[model samples]
Target: MASEWVVAKKCLYLHLPLALTSGGSFLYMEQYIVSARKYRPSTFASVVGQQALTGTLKNAIATDRLAHAYLFCGSRGVGKTSCARIFAKTINCTARTPQGEACNQCDSCRQFNENRSMNIIELDAASNNGVDDIRQLVDQVMVPPSVGRYRVFIIDEVHMLSQSAFNAFLKTLEEPPSYVVFILATTEKHKIIPTILSRCQIYDFNRISIADMVKHMQAVAANEGIETEPAALNVIARKADGAMRDALSIFDQVAASSRGKITYQATIENLNVLDQSYYNRLVDAFVAQDVATSLLIYKEIREKGFDSQFFINGLGLYLRDLMVAANPATLTLLEATDDVRQQMAERAAKLHPTFLYKAMSLCNDADFNFRQASNKQFLIELTLIKLCQLLSPSPDESGSDEGQMRPLESFTTSSPAPHPIDIPAPQPAPAAAPTKAPTPAAPAAVHAPVQPVAPPPAATAYSLGGLSLRSRGASAAKAPTEPSPAAPAPVELHRSKPYSDADVERAWGTVRRSFPAEPMLTGIIEAAVPARKDGDSFELAVGTPMQADIVGKQLATINRTLRNLLENDSVELTVAVCEGEIPPAFWTDAQVLDHIVANHPAVGQLINKYKLRLD
Candidate 1:
């Protein structure tokens, strides 16, 4: 039945044209052209977003200083081939315009436009990139153009040519006939051999700016009788990512979906783009430190089927734009329309510059970790929470110890109200008698109430490991009233006494014993006993630079502890790396066994009975 239907359709199509001819009417079907090719730049003046390059080429042609070989380099869809073609047609035109453009009325221009000109040739090197193809191209170079002054050969994707092909064509490319002009266009110029690059005049094409693309698309939409919102056009241009070809293609898709009326809502829905309004609202939630609202917004985004990574990257870009808009000098950096940029600036005004910077950094971290994250949604939610915390007042202006997280309740709109408590002013304790090492006592806490005192400052809240909440209220409440200035407490003077080497060694042992949790540091300190050099100065040598650095970092703490232990206030200690082999700090298994046998003979017997070896 399918075959019969096909046969009938073929007969209908064959008869329809003949019937129309018999009726003295010919059916001319209109071919639908996509916006990309339909609006492709023809003349140099018509080229979009490439004024400087087009002008240079026009000047070269007008001044009759055209090079025998030219190289055009840029990313895809940036008018490399288009400019090459325009340059070729203009140079070969019998009658040129005063602006250095080809007069389309001339025979050369008309033939090139209609794709029948023998003077111009286009070779797609991506497919024919072998030695034989280069040989064929080289053979064709020998014959000049029959109709025009110069024969132009435009090679597209010139980087795809094989090494052998490049070597084979190098000679001809370097010294082509005077009438032959070679134009090489590539998206990746690094792949092309240096010989080919050196033989040509290189022109680096700029990426079509978003503003340029949007403006050009507007003109195309008008000509196509399609109504479009400026916001919709901006979205399309950004989606293209600096590619005019891509922008026009996206425009065609959106126009079809919207049925000739492209609105912002319809455009985003068609493209499956996350709305910028989500980011705008998210900024508000961050400023308010509203974690719940931010999380809810993330949930809504997930429900709309947007990937978490894409959402995070988009958020980072939005924050970056906000940061850029926060400064007037950088407002031009935003690639958005005036109205959209103005709205962003207004919203950015509400956020602090520091907050925007930190928020952007958080978003960047979330984006970088998105691919490796097992729970992508959770990562995004946590990032959003961190952004909210950026504006929260920190404890003593130092953020949480856990680095980017704090308890949600700790962040408040304002400080909590202080409460009054009646307590007696505590008496000062007597100073301790100087011993070998005197430990400072903590301030005494007042228990019973005697006289009224001023209320303490509001307790600052903090989070421990981002898990539990803690506050300084206990210490703040126990703090005694300030003493009267008439009878001030006496100050204690530090002791600077003379000590022997034995005293220094004993003090070093105490310091080493204190680092029980850090065995490496303990071992490093024990490698050498500090010796007095001059006055109260001393030095200790370690095995390596790393050990020296470790000891250097703790030198101040060690000096303070040692000075207190020795009752000397002028103690100074320095660490030095030794020149030779480092002494072993850890005991080997054999040494341990021998030491155990020497200390307790029964341990060796037990090891022998168990047939155990420490290796």
Candidate 2:
């Protein structure tokens, strides 16, 4: 069997590339290593974005105060597992560096690097999470290390362990052998049982920053002799969303796709990232109120295969950045290259802060309803149109159609008028005294010759024979001579009139009945009866401030109704919340009944004898 295994191994190496061929030629391809694994940190100082945590671990190792159990918790691809492996290897190294890092020259460190270490054990709890598996682990804990002082067991995804498994491993984990060390790692620490958490010292990992990822990628690019642009790397880092592993993987993909040369335009195009140029142009169109150009640009974007919702969200983010850039103090909030930020600031200067606010709000609204909108493109187009109109002048004082696109006629082209039309000058009419003409012609110049009167201004005058009037700037047309109706006269309120307390109470009752829908307000008003302090002053007594607040909301309506009903404009109503020692009469039936029964035994006995109940 040994000889056969030797022969098989020889054959495997010799025939490894036997089947790989392209174009009838043997293709000898070099082994490719992924950046994530190839560049993984091997020592404490080499780990990126976790200096504090690594320092703490190094200090613990230096002090010889390592805990029996440790929990490394963080999101995916944040170096939790890597750090655990490094810690385990460092602790097991016979000769460590002065900085408490593992010395690679040591036998244990060499074994760990070559994946032949016997002191370190890794268990994938995601797969082996049953009680039986945990029992096996507990049994394995009894054995001492053969080459190292401690046997390190690293359990990855420890939260996946079953409840029974957790319980079975709790005792062993709490009081393991002196040479045993358990390291638990999980993406979700909250899922792990509290008992397991209590037995372990927890160390949380944070998501790597974009700058760190970009710097690491730059180093990786330099090592690989690949050309890259900072903007492209920035885009890749953002696309990774704070995962260093994801960023490296994306960097590799982009590098391969671009044939070792990565540029900003190519990167964005390859990743389907909408270029900021589109947003800048859109803002220009918005400032100019160019609806047609904006719609055309939107059509072009749609043709490029961007989703409407994605476009909306991108626009919103752009507008938000613009808002930040619009103010010099808040310019630091923008995350972009200096050139891009300066350009954004320049663009933002042309836009009013109010315009940016309203534009962002419209984009947000469009994005919020995007999923439910059946005609999504129309919604997007409408949003764009609204954004365009945000900078347009308001049409009326009421602002009824503010932030809305004007009619299509507003965008239509028209020729300039040849010359400005002149408004006709006003002509005064000649005043004349009425004279009685001769009933019958006397056949003589009995009446003096009548002087001709100049015609009245055409804008408001009616001709005797024409029976028509021409308004200013309006075409000549006959209009009916109907007089407009007069407006109604305002009601005069009765001020300074005196009324009785009964009148005020009746008015309040009417007010309460008027609001049946508002049961809370009605009940409050019904309970708090109004008491007349003087002929004009009235006070409402409520049991609590909450009731007073409810009544205060309707105070205006109540006062108006009372004034009209009582025929007294001088009547004033006020609300008072009883601060302390409310009278028994104001107490609720249940409270009053309890008080009576508690204070007077006879009252309870009488009620018991009669078998009476309070309604």
Best by lDDT: 1
For every candidate in turn, the CA RMSD to the true structure comes to 19.9, 25.5
Q: Pull out the clashing pairs in model 2.
A: none
Displacement of residue 114 (Cα, Å) in model 2 is 0.7
Listed per model in order, the count of residue pairs whose N, CA or C atoms clash below 3 Å is: 0, 0
Residue runs of model 1 more than 4 Å from their true location after superposition: 1-28, 395-615
Clashes in candidate 1: how many?
Answer: 0
Report the lDDT tens digits of candidate 1 across residue range 429-525.
2233111111111222111111111111123222112211111121211111122233222233677887766666666656764433233344456
Best-fitting candidate, scored by TM-score: 1
Model 1: per-residue Cα lDDT at residue 615: 24
Q: Each prediction's Cα lDDT score? A: 0.69, 0.69
Reference-based lDDT, residue 6, model 1: 57
